[model samples]
Target: MDYLMCHIEKEFFGTTFEGIPIYQYTLVNKNGAMVKIITYGAIVRELWVPGRSGTLFDVVLGFDSLQEYEEKNASYFFGAIVGRYANRIAGGSFKIDGVTYQLALNDGDRPNALHGGVKGFYTRVFKAIPMKTPKGPSLVLKYLSHDGEEGYPGNLDVTVIYTLTNENELKIEYRATTDKPTVVNLTHHSYFNLSGDGTILDHEIMINADHYTPVDENLIPTGEISSVEGTPYDLRSFKRLEDAIEPLKDTPTRGFDINYVLNGKDGELKLAAVLKSKKTSVRMEVYTTEPGLQFYTGNFLDVKGKGGKYYSPYSGLCLEAQHFPDSPNHSNFPSTILRPGEEYRQITVYKFSMEG
Candidate 1:
């Protein structure tokens, strides 16, 4: 077989606390966009996209060292792949097949099970495989979650493939299967600052959704699919993030952290949102198969990131595409249940372009 050549460079990253060796795979597309993925947390350490002037900018927030990511990623999530359940679950508990399961109450005093519990997929090291493809270079990460690992039933096998396409798209494909009945909602958590520096408040954004799931004080969905019309949750038109986040400055969230019900057929990939940075003339278009898009301003980001830069609140923004929060508890929301013999699959693409 003739070996196909692709722009994928693998290098040693660092060791985990348990002395586990970690590796980073750098995938470069034909157009020069780059994405670096590490085995630890199956995280995207950095993503470089080109601006209008052809200057490549690292748009995602990350750490300089493995120790920093290990110590601080829990607070901000960074570029990790979060799962089991992407968002909050009410009271840290849910019922599956008439059996109640209690997950770790890791969401501080709010007492909700956030992101699969204390040891979510973001904390686990995955086995990586790099492959050259016609479309681009791909890095496949595989992880096995044992039954009852995070108070969840069934042993879930997960595979996440990150492909850097020639179209300047960072495509993430998620697939999972379980031996028993389980609920799964996997999503990427990457804090993006399209300008590559400073806050994301000035970025213009638009979401292709006419409805949103309103959250309560704890940030859990209120079980009602409310219309985005005449509401602050509306992002149907492009507007500066500063204008959208300013109204909630005194509220409990302090910024946008609600989930917008994506306007499309669930399970079908469609345009979810678009974020633009006027400073760099870079635009990011998000397309996903998930039914909801969580637009979270970095409301609680007060940590220092790579290059010794201090990131204050609203330093970046996250467009997390996944199922609605507390979907297992919300009967009306799209189902996230995955039973034996059923394969859970989702695809999300972040395509970048220069709009001068």
Candidate 2:
């Protein structure tokens, strides 16, 4: 495996309310693929992958300058780790072992904790440690969440490793341990625009999910496992995202933003979804050990992105692998609780290739 790492001096928006300076590290693979990540929020600044013609194009939406990211509120979250809890917690509250805990509500009057609240892991700057492995160059990021930081229990120490292998696989391994029992569901939120030129509506997507969690008007799951058959949510087989997005444009969020129950065994890696962009002939295969995948079509990206373009809705898509939303509240869903004796581990891989 070919391992490559280079340190470049680049400035970025700071973590505090007052803008500060941050650095960016670029990791490139032998296949001419590369990912630029910054220390601020550990955000993925850009990602370039090879196309069918053996050309490289930036596929992830991001900003060119720190000022742009600060002013626009346009955090593609691009390729950052989201955690504590990956999805929404109803009313910013959940009961664990008969103990009710209140969380920080940041989802705009929804009264629910969305994506780990206002000061989520995405908003924190992680400590990056670069390592050389047999497969490739990897970066291990560690973050410590103090008890009651986000109104959750325990002091959580989380580690996420980003490894770009020689086989064109971007593997993310998540590990965490808490001093007290807590809810932990972490995933990498990478907005992907495989076509590299236009919106993701034309991209063909195939999700191996026969059921999905029905959401309310606020985009919170109603704790029901509804069949995806005959609905716009159906993607059991390969289908263009545009074909099913037109009708749902009038819904609450106005796009495909829902969690799908993966039809596979838990705790074992299995194919989650396959995405192909005909324009660039770029294909990506997603595999994970999680039980569910959240498909978000960049429903709120109307803000300005890099290069003076207002990123319209559906400009990018994210497939986050994790346990179902509100799993702590829903007994039917997979358990997301991690006691002191148990360890949390999850692995997800995005393998890129091109179609002839």
User: Highest lDDT: which candidate?
Assistant: 1
Backbone clashes, candidate 1: 0
- Where does candidate 1 have its weakest 10-residue lDDT segment? 1-10
Candidate 1 segments whose C-alpha is farther than 4 A from its true place: 1-5
Candidate 2 weakest lDDT stretch, 10 residues: 1-10
Candidate 2 contains a number of clashing pairs equal to 0
lDDT of 2 by residue, 27-146 (tens): 766666777777666677777888977988788877777655555432456566787898889888988778989998877867778888777887777788877666765778888989
lDDT of 2 at 147: 90
Per-model TM-score, in order, reads: 0.98, 0.93
Candidate 2 error regions (>4 Å): 4-21, 70-76
| lDDT at residue 89 of model 2 (Cα atoms) | 90
For candidate 1, the TM-score is 0.98
